[model samples]
Target: MVIRDTHSLQLVWSSRISEDSTFGLRWTHSIHRSLVEEKYRIHDGQIILTEMSFHDYGIGMENELAPGEKLDIQDGQFHIRNMNRHFPALHLFIGQVRAGHTLLFSGTEIPLGSLHAPGAAITIQVEKRSILNEIGGY
Candidate 1:
């Protein structure tokens, strides 16, 4: 997987992700001041949004459920499950330090703010590379 700044078209971060690789993006909701997390997995060479958990609903929050989607409440947190939304590329707005935008992958916490300035547009997507290119470190 790779993350790039959309405006400048500069590579911000890149990592080798295999099939079934899962990651979560977490940030503080600007209005609610609560932590919100969205989990995704790489399946069939695509990015699928698996789950979303948040403390409270605020602006831009999805209230109505779609087909095959389920909502669960536990410990005062709302979890939306079975989304399985496919995206060619995930775009995110890197919020300020107060938002605490972070990426959780492979047991590592990477702060997106450290990679680019606040309010930067970031695009994350999976890229296919041949075995030869991988071996050559391209």
Candidate 2:
């Protein structure tokens, strides 16, 4: 749920923004999420939250992030806004949120920071909701 914008990996959610849409015309593909992930599996319609951490020089590195600050979820063609929407949102547990979109390299760090750049270690809090629509499970 918690991921970085990851320029190397671009997951886009295709949606048509109305010219008069509340979200606005400039927002159709204008959405740029710090987190973009796809192809996830839920166990019995549930997600597990676990504590993640990191240590450098045998010491832990820590950073703080607020809710909906820098996170995004994107399917191959669907981008969830800042950990909001029906999708999952990952809360930062021990990392900092870069004000700008982070570029992750192949050697990016996963725990203590990306091999390429600083990465995100999150405290996952999963909530179960109706993933299906009243009309039908799209």
Largest lDDT belongs to which candidate?
A: 1
Q: TM-score winner among the candidates?
A: 1
- Superposition error at 18 for model 2 (Å): 32
Tens digits of lDDT, candidate 2, 16-116: 22221221111111134223222222233233222221211122212343465242223333232332222243333233443232222222323323322
CA lDDT, candidate 1, residue 119? 88
Angstrom error of the Cα, residue 23, model 1: value is: 0.4
What would the TM-score be for candidate 2 when compared with the true structure?
Answer: 0.18
> What TM-score does each of the candidates earn?
0.90, 0.18
Worst 10-residue lDDT window for candidate 2 reads 21-30
Off by over 4 Å in 1: 130-138
Stretches off by above 4 angstroms in model 2 are 1-41, 50-53, 56-138
